[model samples]
Target: MLQSSDYDPLTAAMRPPPGETQEQREEREAAEAEALEVSNRIDAEIKASKQAMKRQKKPIRVLVLGQSMSGKTTTIKNFQMIYAQKSWAEERSSWHIVICFNLVRNVNTIADTLNEETTDSILTGRRSSLTEWHRSVLFRLSPLRRIENDLKAFLGAGSSESVEIHHPNRPNTSDGLRDSPSAQQISPPEDAKRPQEFCIWSSSGWKSILNQVKTRSAQGKESQVPRMVRAVLNSCKDDIHLLWNDPVVQSLLRAKHGRLEETPGFFLNDVDRILSTDYTPGDEDIVRARLRTTGVQEYRFTLDKGTGTSRDWVMYDVATAWIPYFPDITALIFLAPVSSFNERLMENPRINRLEDTFVLWKTVCSSKILANVQLILFMNKTDILRRKLEHGYQVKDHIPEFGGNKNEFSSVLEWFRRVFRKLFTDNNSSLNRKFIAHFTNVIDTKATQHTLQAGKFSTSRSESMALRYGCFKVQAAILRNDIEEAGLM
Candidate 1:
């Protein structure tokens, strides 16, 4: 009986005046419609807000992929130099080891060549044991041994390091492998101090190499002496420079047919200043420095979004079929070296480097996995190509295509541009994708810095474009979530 009175349908707040006019009723209905419209707009805005949160949570990831020595790593280094300098400084020590190695290996090669010529049984060509000269040259190059030893110790190779390596006894030595040294223990002094903290500049390792590498024979001061060991002859540069110039050295180079002059990373032609006692690697030196990226490496940095706004960015240094692919790839930056048009692969001397780039480009462009992903092609190493053309190196000599084409740099560069542009255009008509490319001398910071800015702008545009397409999907997802929550089929 109390409940019937307590629950009143016609309460004071809900009451409308009796004998209300038709105009008032119409106005009341319009007000209710306005409220419903406002409610719908709020619900739409809430759904939009959640979708925006999802977009903001997902980071933009760019991948740098290319063959070995095609300037892929240099492009990444350029990005680091522009965005992250502190990280670059910390990793500079590793380069010192590479520089030292080049010098020692070249001298040993020279000494071996000299000893072989003296034997002149070059007929049997029976591998020379040649212990006497090997030991002599090994002892001569002992000063640089400290840096190598430190590298091994730092890399956790564990003592059992050797000084005098019998090249034949080296385990896992790859043919034509100029970079790796085998561990054949020669007599290292007992109870030596542990490697003094991986700092080559402060360590006496550099000083010893400079002191020990003097050539007794300097018949003439002509050039072409240092060409053979140009890749590894940075340490003890002065002695090696003269030694390389020596007639005997040149004679050995001519006999071996070692054409070190044309190749990139032949720093023996220039970059001597970095060998000095107090030298630090300059931006250019680091770019030109011969450190092949062996595996995938991730680099992260904070992007300058705007005043009072910023975001974190990540980039991956990726690989190819010869190298593995990056599973974390979001966007692709493919570097095609223009200079490689006339060059052969270090891995397979039979195949042209540019040909390999074309195969890689096709693989990346046609991949179903990356069908809708952003793709940017970087036509890198333009500066080196310019030098090659000016110095009279003809492309036709190496590549049979473009028979009798004008040998001028611009004309030749245009030809390559057409080749790349036509490749994606003709093969994948259904994709209907426009190919974008940039001419970059990647080692040049100014060029790559501009290129990166453009790349970022293009990337953001692509992400927004993707967002437009993802809008419907996101709305459907929200509706599904609501249905599940309500237990509705």
Candidate 2:
């Protein structure tokens, strides 16, 4: 009984025209079919997009924490090399300038040290091991100084700042290592100061610095700075070899400055290969290269689990200013250099490096914000510790509390592990949390890759368990409410 004009306007418009010709009807039908197909395709696309959004999980967040030079950045590099191989390969060539800069810095540091020794010998009227021949060798190596400056300029302001130690708030005296007698004893002499080393900040546009190299290479107009650096290094390679091999230089480094060979980024041994005309960094070289990160660095990866599943992960390499912003992280990878028992932080020579790490660890464990966060302790630099013990560096001499323990690798490592575990157990309030530790030398890519893979698996499992536990709590609450409503409780 409804009039045709009263029907829905949209439906009425779609009806066939009155008294339409056969050709016109056929054309209209075809057009209507085409419109319907387009509409269906768009609907399919929208559905697929919604499904993809559901499948895409929230990114897994991780935070890497350590004192300066504790291999935090190196650990990140290992992750990229393993999980993000394509991007890692793309960036490998850009590390050439950084490696070259490290070599030049080493040469310059040695030259300055030798010059200081000579000047001291002259001032004190003491006989020196360095002769005129050594002086000439130093003179011949002076071009490296200019090259170093050029590389530093190219790397930007991050490489120009002095590396400083960041002191965070400590726990109360009842729970801290700051007031311990051993900590007191670890302080260096008032006059002692560490030499300045090359450092870069995360904000210094490292990617841009690297990309400049890549972009230039792609454009076939390589920068003169790189060409000049190679030229200088190639020219001075033999003198570098001679200076590093000189008995006097070795003795000075051992007796005064600690062994340069043991330090990160010691490329003097590989001078021949590194300084060759056609040198590109290998995986090991890129891993071994040292450029101290002064601020926070973030890395993202789309990791495939090989089970037709993939996950997105974001890892942060952080310095001291990490607490407030990153309390929501899924896991914290704390790196403590177990070998730093005898050394001091480069920024603050007074505080023992090991003590600093202990204080930092204590602070982290005691944080209320990170209570639910999974903690993974990496007692790193064990390889260096083993080498030190083999070289007869006594732990007892530096750490008085290490009294009477065997100076072998296992005993020393166990002793250090016990200390770190104790700190965690004593400071952490969460009883459900388990202590996880790994001895890592992050410079060894193969070994570290295996450890990191295991770490990734463990972290994922922990996250899954946490999610399940949360669900169980929510379900239990719901059941309790239902029972109360039904008067069953």
Candidate 3:
């Protein structure tokens, strides 16, 4: 070992002269500080290298793909509600306007459906006729046309001027009144701007309409609107139950072959509750609100627990077109609406909606982009499917291959499962990729939460014996099923 004084001669040689000036000492001290800083920077570089390795292991990036109205966006919303809750309250405030518009649109539909009614006792009571009430409501609501149009434009309908109307009620409660950031209302432009979205503010015409309502209410003015018309909006649960159950409306719906009965969110059902000046959509209403997915949108939230310790969750809500080609995908969540079996595609009425969904699934499954990625199929809208069963809908009538032997939920579900499995088995390059399936209501947050907890890692985790065991079982079942059907098992 070196002695403590071994460096004394070298130290003396480096020291300043006996009468060294203050400037010389200052320069020495500065040099020491510079050396120390260099040492610290070297330590920092070592630390940064380690952190870079961790960041290179990026969090799971899930892709949510489906045809329009396949619940992709709703799934993203649920993810936010479950995870990034600090912001959901703020975002939900913007939906108050949307809920109001839904109510008005439903009432308008009913009125249009029954405009020819003249002698129906249910509609023409001594109080007032339903047609007359519809006319009065439409007359009073003429001012809202601009507001509705603007709201639609903002929701990605088309590039149009956003109309902002005076919000009559600014409730102090925490429900949202904020608008989506995608679009905003602006004053008339002198020069053309990038046409994207529209917004509406408190214009004079809108304010005047609310003022008339307040004045009339203050004076207890006699109203031409029927008490039943008021009931259609006034009694939240009971009134709409009555309206839909009305014998006259039922007769008219059957005569026209309209699908009002088969659908949910009859906004008429929640009219009065949603229309009341105090109306603010609750969490459930926001979940249930029917907004069509228009374009490729993304939602991100930090999961408390999922896939891995990264806690970061990113899911893309994509429609049929303009989907990004992401090479590093962790999972692909493909959705098909099971209840849409008997419906027609909104965009192409000539095609069956279920058939459209099958085409979409096949296309997505066959894509080379997702060849190695895991597959998760969600047979969404179980609640609607159950209701359709209770309503005595025969699946074979709509899907003839389903065979008339069985018309229940289980049989129909199995048929769909087999259809998807056959698609996968037929196209598999080596049958190495696994196809996982779930019956999802999607709207039920608890059910979806459970699915996330169970299948959370199904997409991101590396192959393991246990997971491969599950995959083998899935494949074995499919093989056994095929053999049984072929009478060769």
TM-score of each: 0.56, 0.80, 0.63
Candidate 1 lDDT by residue in tens digits, 1-489: 558869777685556668989999888879879999999999999999999887663444667677666666566555555445455565554455445444344454555566556586556766544445444544555554454444333323232211211111112212221111211112223532121212222122222222222211133432232222233344456565655666656655544533443333345544366455566656665655543323356666554422122444466666555223545445567878777665544333444567667766777777766665556677776777888688787777666665699999889888888777766665543364446565655344443343343322222333211111111112112222222232322
Q: Provide the overall lDDT of each model, using Cα atoms, as 2-decimal numbers.
A: 0.50, 0.69, 0.52
Q: Which ten residues in a row have the lowest lDDT in candidate 1?
A: 464-473
- Steric overlap count per candidate: 4, 0, 11
Model 2 steric clash pairs: none
All candidates in order of TM-score, best leading: 2, 3, 1
| lDDT of model number 3 | 0.52
Query: Highest lDDT among the candidates is held by which one?
Result: 2
Q: What lDDT tens digits, residue by residue, belong to model 2 across residues 1-489? A: 888778798877888889999999999999989999999999999999999999776666778788767877666666566556677789998998889988998899889889989999999999998899999999999998889888877776654443332222211222124443333345545654545666666543245567777888999988799889988898898898899998889888666656666666768888888877678898778777877656667777665432133666677877655677987677777878888777755544555678778888888888888888777777787777878789887877666668899999989888887787788889995776767665655365443333343422322333211211111112212222222232322
| Winner on lDDT (2 vs 3) | 2
Candidate 3 Cα misplacement greater than 4 A, ranges: 1-22, 31-46, 49-56, 111-144, 150-266, 275-280, 305-310, 320-324, 445-489
lDDT of model number 1 = 0.50
Instruction: Output the better candidate (1/2) by lDDT.
Output: 2
**How do all the candidates rank in terms of lDDT, highest first?**
2, 3, 1
